[model samples]
Target: MRRAAWGFLTPFLALFALFFVLPLGYALVRSLYAVRRPGLGFGPASVEFAALRNYAAVLADPVFRSALGRIAVLGLVQIPVMLGLAAVLALLLDAGLARAVRWFRLGFFLPYGVPGVIAVLLWANLYVPQVFPLAWTDLLAPPYVLAAIGNIVTWEYVGYNTLILVTALQAVPRSLIEAAAADGAGPWRTAWSVKLPLLRPALVLTATFSIIGTLQLFSEPAVLRTITPAVSAGYTPNLHVYNTIFTDDLPHLGAAQAVLLAAVTFALSIAFLRVTRRWSAA
Candidate 1:
């Protein structure tokens, strides 16, 4: 049985190291070197070690700083709103408060099935006045673009989060809920006192996933960039990294930025998990 377990684990371990570990290692190494031209116009470019140069440049960039700030704000607002809606919907479905529960479940989760880029484009048409001709307002306008993107994200994932919570709800022993009802506990009272308390673990998991997703905000703004100048090349950190490498032709600096972004994301995720553990303990 031990040998069989090792056999099952070997393939996953190999793939994880090959795909994740190797790429991360390569990016870290790449961030330490730069392409240097020895002469003003005559020499061929060569790789040279300049360990701190790339990282310093990225850190000094105001746009990169703003990109980080933008996502921070977006996550603050969007994560709670998305999770709250998911909790409400999951409770409604679990209690059979709405008709056609099965159909509604499918309908809620369907947006998540659509590819992210396709969903962004579909929403783009609705928000871009040129395409829809009846768009109520310019959601892609500079001041509103971040909120617009948040709406798209919420629409895509709220259903996914709802289903996760719903599965958690199903795992709950039916007898406990029945006992609560027998004691004349109303739906709201039962949810607040019984169901919500039991949902703590699932809620924490979803919130953590939401935090990671918020930092990974790229494709929506990148897609929107094609339609409007509101999304600059450095609109989001990921987008900035992309344009830095491809558009500005600075792969080493891009790699540095990527590494720093990964570090920030990892740090924030760990902090959140630690805070939640403390909450659970208390």
Candidate 2:
């Protein structure tokens, strides 16, 4: 039986090792080395094992630190707002808005189907004063650009999270809802007492996804850079990594920063899951 199970998993294991493990190992190895150019940049570049120097440089960079702080603020604000809207929409659908449910669901999810870059371009037009004349170009300025990006992200993913919550709501036992109704419970009471509790797992799932997505914010700001001076090349951690590798030609430093970002993301996700689990238990 064990042999049969191994046979069934062998192909998947091989692909996982080939794709995930190999690339990660390469990045880790590359991140430990730094490029050295001798004699006023006239000599051949050499690779030197630099230990934690790349990580130290990435941590010391003001641009990278500012970008990290920006996204941290964005996730704190945007995740709650996005998830709240999604929960409301899901509850509305589950509340038996039968006739319009299909149309509403499709409309809400349509943005998710649009390619992210295209969506950013479409939104940029609305934000650019010359294009839309809404006089909202101020929203794309320094103090508000993070919020603008947050708005774009919320619009794109709210529907996706709604669908996830709605699926969880549907899996809820109808008998439980009927019993609540028999007890003279109102819709709000039933949702608060029955549905919301049942929706906890789905909420955690969506929240985790939102956290990861917010941390990896790249496309919208990258696209918006062309239209606004507010967005720097290092507008997000992912953007900073991209700029380091391509724009600055510091692949080792970029790799180190990327690895550190991944570590932070992983730690946060685990912490969130632990907190949610404890809350659910309580």
**Can you give the lDDT of residue 4 in candidate 1?**
100
Instruction: List, residue by residue over 124-224, the lDDT tens digit for candidate 2.
Output: 76766787877555678888888888888988999999999999999999999999999999999999999998998899999998888888888898988
Best candidate, lDDT-wise?
Answer: 1
Clashing pairs in 2: none
Give the Cα RMSD of candidate 1: 1.8
How much is the lDDT of residue 39 in candidate 2? Answer: 93
Each model's number of backbone clashes?
0, 0
Q: How do the predictions measure up, each by TM-score?
A: 0.94, 0.94
Tens digit of per-residue lDDT, candidate 1, span 1-282: 999999999999999999988988898999999999878846999999998999999999999999999999999999999999999999999999999999999999999999989999999889977778777789899989999999999999999999999999999999999999999999999999999999999999999999988887888999999988999999899999999999999999999999999899889989999998999999
lDDT of 1 at 107: 98
lDDT of 1 at 100: 98
